[model samples]
Target chain A: MPSLPDMATPEAERLAQEAAQPADPHITDVALKPALFDWLCRMGDGALILGHRTSEWCGHGPALEEDIALANTALDLIGHAALWLELAAEVEAQGRTADDLAYLRDAMRFRNPQIVELPNGDIGRTLMREFLYDAWHYEMLLKLRDSSSPRVAEIAAKAGKEVAYQLDRASDLVIRLGDGTEESHARMQAALDHLWPYTGELFTDDAVDEAVAEAGIAPRASELQGPWDATLREVMGEATLTVPDRRADVHLGGKQGRHTEHLGYILAEMQFLQRAYPGAEW
Target chain B: MVTDTLPSTDTIRNWLGEVPDPEIPVISVTDLGIVRDISWQGDTLVVAVTPTYSGCPATAFINMEIEAKLRDKGIEDFRIERRLSPPWTSDWLTPEAREKLRAYGIAPPIDGTAPDGRTAARAARLAGRSNLAVDCPRCGSTDTEKVSQHGSTPCKAAYRCRDCLEPFDYFKCI
Candidate 1:
């Protein structure tokens, strides 16, 4: 557990207050549970890894606008991770700060998918990844709004809007790239071919899903796949790219915390501060 | 002093309606869909708010503003919960608030209600058959090109004028 500053300060009181208020009774009630905690941690880890990956594009984007957009989205994902990590900390009753969970966790312990951990290959590849993730994330949030768990629903409702924006941007980029020129179209198709194998991992389920689903707090990952595929297909078609045929015999274990080699590096950069200066605060 | 029932949560909510968002002063946090709910847990008042985006940077300030505003009203035991699960959306932009955003030199977020809310309306109110005129903020020229999908901040995008060659920000609908 990370040691926070003295709890008597005005700021601490404010933070406590902010964390204590519950939303709609119906939604908030169902969201509070042990299962939700684990789900949030997994979800937060995913966002944190992806945020770090996207942040790498800060000054290297093909265009100024794209640079800002990717940076802003990275910031948004980081913010989302902080929120979910806070919830996860609260679940354990461990008093861990969002910074603690985000910066302290080691690589092997993280549950973010290998796809997010992968480097942004190219502008077209980056856009395709964003399109696929945003499509799933946006659609998930939409469904989550009506979830039995109000807290989850509430967060989903709010996140749905952001993901919707991301989806639109991805859609625009896909169309622009797929229809822009022959080279661009060919590159996008190649990007799809490269990214296709990893897409299977997104929906693969295991023990964690079993736990969360039984709790009624999180919908199954498989449940989100159909819509995810449909959306991806439509966008890829518009981009003049064909969806790469499903690559069978591919291993899937992101949900189980078995990640790609890149995750280690991403975690090292993210966790360096916490491990170096244990309990250090800005 | 004779004891009386504390003001209902609704009363506190009504009082909070006076607190507007710091950036877009024309809109209140309530109208922005950030404020989730207000309630009383014993003598303590709890206010729930969600940030427009995760790591919005404005959230810390918004949380402080809520505390100060409520404290100003003499309600000290109040709490503010910043929930981030269901993220904030542009759909929450109230009709009046949307107009205010536009007037503030930021193109109001498109309601996702088909792309032609202002472009078509402004066209119908114009003399030409084409409806793409964006009415330049500086020179009032209809000729413009969206130069970038990003601007000075995450919430806005950039547009350039073909007529006057001036660049301005469009508050995108996110």
Candidate 2:
């Protein structure tokens, strides 16, 4: 087998090559800078992958009310994804539609953070993951509502309301599960412990985020950290849960298209119908 | 009264007012304030619409129904434009439509001093806990409790009234 460093070099080179090329050759608009376009895709891809995971619980939730709630949340995320991806397609100036970006891309091309692509282990784990993400998503949307790009601003303004509700639902559920029976409390704590390391990736800033921030299209990912921490601390405090200590070696690189094993399975299931029957529409 | 020229914008708007909402049959599209604007672009008529919520599944159906209704009226050259800014809210529901929702056994959203209090409340709810008072349509009592945030449809919430002991869907302020 090749050495770990040798494997890393080729992947890094491939990513560099991919970055140099425009997502679509047909895109001729110089105004839509490549960095900003990538940032938009990152936002949309995160929502799409996470939304797909949430939708898996459609008929299998612990309770009837929860089943409906999860489905509703999934729909909201998917809707937000459509808006962002549609904008991304416009920025690319290609004939590619939102569905093209969503269903056609391979796992290696997705820009979603690794945290969202992780398997939904259980209700406790799922809500914990969602709470972490929704808090950051809500804060980011709050800032994006004033984005310099009119399209981004419009999409953010509409999606902000939906994300707020998602944050509320997830926060409430985390508190309920954390403060409930002994078994539930232990499970919730364990879920948080398992997922805590992934939380750091949500606030990791890179060139794409910096470019988008400079252009006033989105707030820097680092700027969201303080508010995210405050919200998590408050919610966790109320739930009688402790914030796990940050690990020094947090997994990264999902923004650069490197993902966990789970993404392939998700793509396989989500893209099956679309790939099998191209141009299939209802 | 018939003429070779197409009907005026006012006439088309009036005809659209007769098209009932697919989900809430009691309210017309115009009454629900989903129809934002109507204008003529060359020979084709354009109707601007905004969905009540971003992810509302009813939007496509509403668009299709609007097109079919206009086509049925012998006006085939029409297009629907979706407007996202000035987003749709429950406040847009006309007073007449509010009454109709109540009569249909669904609680109408509360009118507030703020233009879109529900949207505002959602932001507030994230910061802390905020609750909106939804009066029961049956007993007209203020004693009601939210059972679940998710309801039969995306636009409604499940609520139960204490006095009437009946569960009803509240057209939640969005």
Candidate 3:
């Protein structure tokens, strides 16, 4: 079956023309200063660490299809990490490459949220954590798509689609397991409770977030609260899972480079190749 | 700056067009809408490219292929500039290219511009509604179900036609 050729709309043509311009003034003036670089590192680290954790399931997923899905999701996250870290390196201007930033940094120097660094306890826990994180990530990327830094905006634009798909998949699983059977529902609920405290850290704004927000590089983490809450509530409702109490004490400090105990082990494993053989190339 | 020894931009573009996409062999890089811009700086030729998917593993290979093709054409002092702004969209796939993809048994993307003509498919993706109905390439049936959101490559998704019961890849809306 032959398909019709996609005709370029006038708007698309205009966008194409705009892209062809020698240089965008908005892009030329946007430099990855210290604050922006820090913000980018936080974003990149979250993806990298979570991607590493998810990759642990590559061959062990419950089913063949799930194995492929998890691997693909891991690849997407790592890909986003590469973009963010590459930009961070460019801003640092210390001759650091994406790999350098990814592999050379110790656990204490990493800035991913506490939630992503935790162990993937079970399929229930894993999907619950992913669902929560993906929701925030999807909302965050939507705002980032309009960042003053054209590079961030572009990366967000490309990565947002992948995150959306992940969110959909995770949400589906959450609903399925939450409403499936008594044991399954109980397991998912328990996972939700276990992962809930870590989510508060995702929205706690700090100096780095403030600076980036001021510089138009990213939105304030606090700004994502409403959307994140609404999404969580809606998905949980469909899944027949109870929403955890919000007043519970929140976990914090991952953004400030202090991570949970799990992060150190993750770093040790992930950076082993580079640390053992510096400058190793595939 | 024009130099007597250098080929024209048109000549360079045509030569680059001959380089096929490493993954989708039936289509050229240009057909895939990856070769965004070609320019000259001093004596060096700059080819700007955007990856179809940010995490696409084929990006490095694609760049290598382009470099090899240019070198084979006896062009030296060239650099491949990776452009992120105006990130690649399936909408950029030219009409001719879409037809070629369909002919190759991979369904091309739907017209990203819906009836309102403003909402491009990428926007739909950002809104988390990417599973747009895709017709089967073999039986031309709209009744198809997505078997998996992923396929052999990052750019495509797996689907099976309800009518034909044939599994195929849908060049995903992204």
Candidate 4:
């Protein structure tokens, strides 16, 4: 049968043929594939880490509605994580799968930005963190949709719609909590201040970013800050929460594989089953 | 010995129609629009399926069931392909699926397209309620309210009807 021209192909088959089609086959750089692989890990790591953090609230949400909503959000992020890591594995051209990368790697190898790995302090902080992350996440996906790399663009299209829904919810809740009663308002403001330092790492671009952006595989990490700021400005203004003006470069090194101690604790819990029993499957 | 002629594409679709969605048992995978395409690749059968949402955990199980059903139908040469582009959409749900959802006490998605875009979503935030006016699946009253933007599953949102005081799941648009 003829290939279905309308249907999207698998990532592996596409990547295998990616270099042959000369239109914009940047994967031929051989040197660039590792950088692309690292960049993909950053995308996957953040989603997986934040998804794990959000899922900690599975049965513990402040309210039933919030509980169910947070769990759903966690599921969506995990799903995105799986997709990104799957692509990352394919690019590594190594014999590893997404599961192996997720369950086998040590914390030192993880490449998620620092903000996501921080503890979910409280309901206010959790919501505040999600809102902050969602704003940045949405902005990046919007730009990734235009990536010259087909795999990046395809996953972006698939994940973009869901992130929009997530951002919408997170921003709405942040506004209500930030502008509500005095107690809630104070708590939200506190959460913002605590989380503000972490947000700086999200835009700290480096060599991996430069390689991917030059290859047209992904955008520079710093490019996303502009749109992220626009969203935070509009949403924070409405929420009556003030953006911390201290600094935007207070934290960095997450994308470069330097992570906080929290990631190790997270991995112990997250990877216990797979670590204890190698290649375990249900 | 097998015959040279394979089952028609329509016949394969009919067999797939027997597979119920794991979460929403009332609807078949076809009804939910997860099965995107079916065709023969030489002697092998190719089935393209898209997950309703990227993170839905049920996708692997659903794929297994599809494989099992096809195998049970005596089709040994087959492969499942995942389609992501022209990504899955709720608008693809069959009209009959909407009816079945209503009968099952889950509100059909508001006759809405794709995701409610940012502008409409922001408007709902401003209005302090959902933009879509969802009718009660049970009481059939228009006076209903959204309880949460998400629900027990990624594909659903939670809502409640004022007249019936009944909480239900709304098949989320996109």
Task: Identify the leading candidate in terms of DockQ.
Answer: 4
**TM-score (chain B only), all candidates:** 0.72, 0.86, 0.85, 0.95
Chain A TM-score values for every predicted structure, listed in order:
0.89, 0.88, 0.89, 0.91
Off by over 4 Å in 3: A1-33, B1-5, B113-131
* lDDT of residue A252 for candidate 2: 87
Worst 10 residues of 1 chain A by lDDT: A1-10
For candidate 3, lDDT tens digit of each residue in B8-125? 8889888878888888899899888889899888787878888777777777777777877888888867667677767687888889998888889999988552212112323444
Q: In terms of TM-score, which candidate is stronger, 2 or 3?
A: 2
Instruction: Give the root-mean-square deviation of each candidate in angstroms.
Output: 5.7, 9.0, 7.5, 4.7
- When candidate 1 is compared with the true two-chain complex, its DockQ is 0.32
Give the candidate number with the greatest TM-score. 4
Question: How high is the lDDT of residue A234 in model 3?
Answer: 80
For model 4, what is the alpha-carbon lDDT of residue A55? Answer: 96
Give the Å error, residue A206, model 4.
Answer: 0.8
lDDT of 2 by residue, A36-139 (tens): 67888898999989989999999999988888888888878888888788678767766676778888999888999999999999999999999989988988
DockQ of 3: 0.21
Candidate 4, residues A140-215, lDDT tens digits: the string is 8888889898778878988998998898888888888888999999999999999898898888889889989998
Question: What TM-score, to 2 decimals, does candidate 1 have?
Answer: 0.80
| Candidate 1 lDDT over residue span B44-99, tens digit each | 77777766765566666677777777777777676666655545566777787766
Each predicted complex: what DockQ?
0.32, 0.24, 0.21, 0.37
What are the per-residue Cα lDDT tens digits for candidate 1 across A1-282?
Answer: 232211222466455644643553432334445555557778888777877888899999888888888898887777667656766776666666666777776766677777788878888888888877777677666667776666666666655665665666677777678878999999888887887788777787766776667666677888889888777766666567887667722746765678887788877777777788876765
How close is every model to the real structure, measured as TM-score? 0.80, 0.88, 0.86, 0.93
Clashes of each: 16, 0, 0, 0
Tens-digit lDDT track of model 3 for A1-282: 000111122232232333432332333334536676778899999998998899999899888777777888888899899888877776776777677889899887888999999999988999899999998998999899888877788889878877876787787778778989999999999999989888888889888899888878788999999988988888898799998876533778898888889998998998888888887754
